[model samples]
Target: MRTSAPAAVLFDMDGTLVDTEVLWWETAREVAAGLGHRLTDADAPEVVGRAVADTAAHLIGVTGATPPPSPPPPTTGPPRWRAPQPS
Candidate 1:
């Protein structure tokens, strides 16, 4: 028996394959610092696992960052992907 290719694949990156929670924490801290606020342990819960726009909005409300820019227009095509080849 053979299987067809999947139409899409999804991976949970934050705590599964890669430890990105620290990266997000540090990044939020850095951005808060740049905007004249120091992020604390209390702040981590709100910033973790949020979209960039949501994070930016939170920063604006807390640290006064300039409003986030509007997103760019969508492109006209299905996104391209490349499957890994067997080695």
Candidate 2:
């Protein structure tokens, strides 16, 4: 292990690395729309950079969504294809 002072560190607090912020915003907007709620620039504080569960809970509260309850019992056979395996 080399333990001199570190040469550098990297962080992406505001998406300079890959700029997925817009994708996150767009997806949140679409989901909000599906929940019969509308999201705008004003909603960013509650939606952007939030954990998925937190955002999901926020949407549920804002739109009175129950998020469809637990999933229905699994379908059998064909549509229930086996889980994928890595090569």
Candidate 3:
């Protein structure tokens, strides 16, 4: 399998993989606002991976969404993966 190309690839991960502490979208909106530009709520999802020029263009095109206040970092605890005890 390692030597051959995958006929079908499957991606899998636990909920741990979903953990993210940063709010880059919020940061971008804040910076844009500080630069005298406004970003609305509807515009955030579209801004995720594009270049700065493209993002700015999208914002300009949509007239931007009202960016909400930054959310607090997601609270986390130690993973609960534990071995079962013998009865």
Candidate 4:
């Protein structure tokens, strides 16, 4: 079987490439609070940087419309993490 080569890279906004996964989860929790549903940090990382629809769908599956999808907060810090792909 032929394997496909990688074609892209992703970098963290924090520059350290540290798992901002927690940050996204925290933010999501805060946002979800407004809807009267409490989302735990464990549930947040799954939808970071996803489109509103995707986030909404995940939320629907998770808390059932507790957190309305919206634009995430602006990102800050140097670029972190990278994945190179062949062109």
Task: Give the best candidate by TM-score.
Answer: 1
Q: Is candidate 2 or candidate 4 better by lDDT?
A: 2
- Candidate 2 vs candidate 4: the TM-score winner is 2
Each prediction's TM-score versus the true structure: 0.64, 0.58, 0.34, 0.40
Instruction: For residues 48-81, write the lDDT of model 4, one tens digit per residue.
Output: 7664556666676766564445755434455564
The lDDT for every candidate, in the order shown, is 0.77, 0.75, 0.57, 0.62
Candidate 2 is scored at a TM of: 0.58
Off by over 4 Å in 2: 1-16, 68-87
Clash pairs of candidate 3?
Answer: 39-65, 40-64, 40-65, 40-66, 41-65, 41-66
Model 1: lowest-lDDT 10 consecutive positions:
71-80
Q: What is the lDDT of residue 14 in candidate 2?
A: 64
True lDDT of residue 74, candidate 4:
39
In model 3, which regions exceed 4 Å deviation?
Answer: 1-22, 49-53, 56-87
Superposition-based RMSD of candidate 1 using all C-alpha atoms, in angstroms: 6.4
* Model 3 agreement with the true structure over 1-87: per-residue lDDT tens digits: 358444554433322455222355776677677667777766666676555555655655555555436533333467455545445
Q: How should the candidates be ordered by TM-score, best one leading?
A: 1, 2, 4, 3
Q: What is the C-alpha RMSD of each candidate to the true structure, in Å?
A: 6.4, 11.6, 13.0, 11.9
lDDT of 1 at 81: 59
